[model samples]
Target: MSLVVPAAALGLVAGAGTRWLLVRLPRGAPVPVGWCEAGLAACWAAVALAVQAGRLDPRWAALLAALSWLAVAGSATDLLVRRLPNALTVPALGLVLVALVPAGSGAVQRGLAGAVLLGGAYLVVHLVSPHAMGGGDVKLAAPVGAAAAGAGWALLPVVAVGAAVASAAVALVAVVAGRAGWGSRLPHGPVLLGVALAVVAVAVPGPRIPG
Candidate 1:
């Protein structure tokens, strides 16, 4: 109960750091400093609630927080530069491995396998049509896959479907608003990371404690 405020404060600090990184990174667009700060603050608050409700394993908290940070960082970079840097994505996979260690051998195995599978699938797609998917997204997929599978493999599909649907919807809106034309590419990293975060929220839900 008491941790939520402090967690949110920590998240704001992390978000400020993220905003600083975004400003320093090569970018074609202005960074949304306020949005990033708010997003992480909200994510941390949610994490605290999940923890308080006993829905999330304390052992997995660090992984959850790290994933949240990665999502924000990757999305901002991809949207601003249309590139996902190895700077953000590669270290995320390593962090996933480090974060999942305390969850035991089975979890570590599942996380690694999930990483390979998702990363491989994206790599194949990137090879087939470089225009359709970016290298950054392929790299980003590994950590997201590992995190989802570490929680439970069933979420892999949820992440897939959610991302696809969200992407399509965003594209539709862009077209309708005349901001983009048909077949134009939108930054996909945001949709992927956003859906992954949504899945994490769903996976962590527990019965509400009656006040």
Candidate 2:
């Protein structure tokens, strides 16, 4: 088989396996909403590989992929535990930075800047309106920032546009289903994941998740 296709498939397996491992954590989240975790890893990994091969800028693709997983892993954590834990977010923060070395210097900058922006925003939100956000979410910023910052300034728009669009879509879906009300509580993590992936698609359009 061709290298890209098989690698893509492996990504899917890895994503799903990550989910299974997530289940073993203390969180109470149930089965995933969909194959999102799998999609996130497998899909982005393929892109990362392609970019590394010079099909795209290795740095940008890695940044996109890392951010994409932050959204994915965070969302999944919240879904399972209703809270994002340092157990996951902390290591993930380190992981994101480590993942950038090969992407290039631009990626390294993006990783740093994005992490700062995301963490700072989470902190402000937590201190002022803790209900609107979680401390764990703040911890998630390191990785998110690392990934986005590494990708380039263009990713900033991807994140912003993706977040807005995904939020509206989810709200629209809830309203159509009649489950969410004017003040109903929703899982922001999943919304964030959706937005991140959307940004990736915009940045690096390609096949569906690996499997």
Strongest candidate by TM-score: 1
Residue ranges of candidate 2 with Cα displaced over 4 Å: 28-55, 59-61, 172-176, 204-211
In TM-score terms, candidate 1 sits at 0.87
**What TM-score do all the candidates reach, one by one?**
0.87, 0.74
Question: Which 10-residue window of candidate 2 scores lowest in summed lDDT?
Answer: 202-211
Candidate 1 pairs with clashing backbones: none
Give Cα-based local distance difference scores for all models: 0.79, 0.64
Clashing pairs in 2: 29-80, 107-150, 110-149, 110-150, 111-146, 111-150, 114-145, 115-145
RMSD of each: 3.8, 5.2
- Candidate 1: C-alpha lDDT: 0.79
Instruction: Give the per-residue lDDT of model 2 (tens digit) for 1-211.
Output: 3456655666666677667766676754344735554666466656756655656554455545555666666776676667776666778767777777765665566677887886787688779977666677667655665565555567765665566577677777898899787655566666665665555546544332221
Number of backbone-clashing residue pairs for each candidate, in the order shown = 0, 8
Q: Give the worst 10-residue stretch by lDDT in candidate 1.
A: 202-211
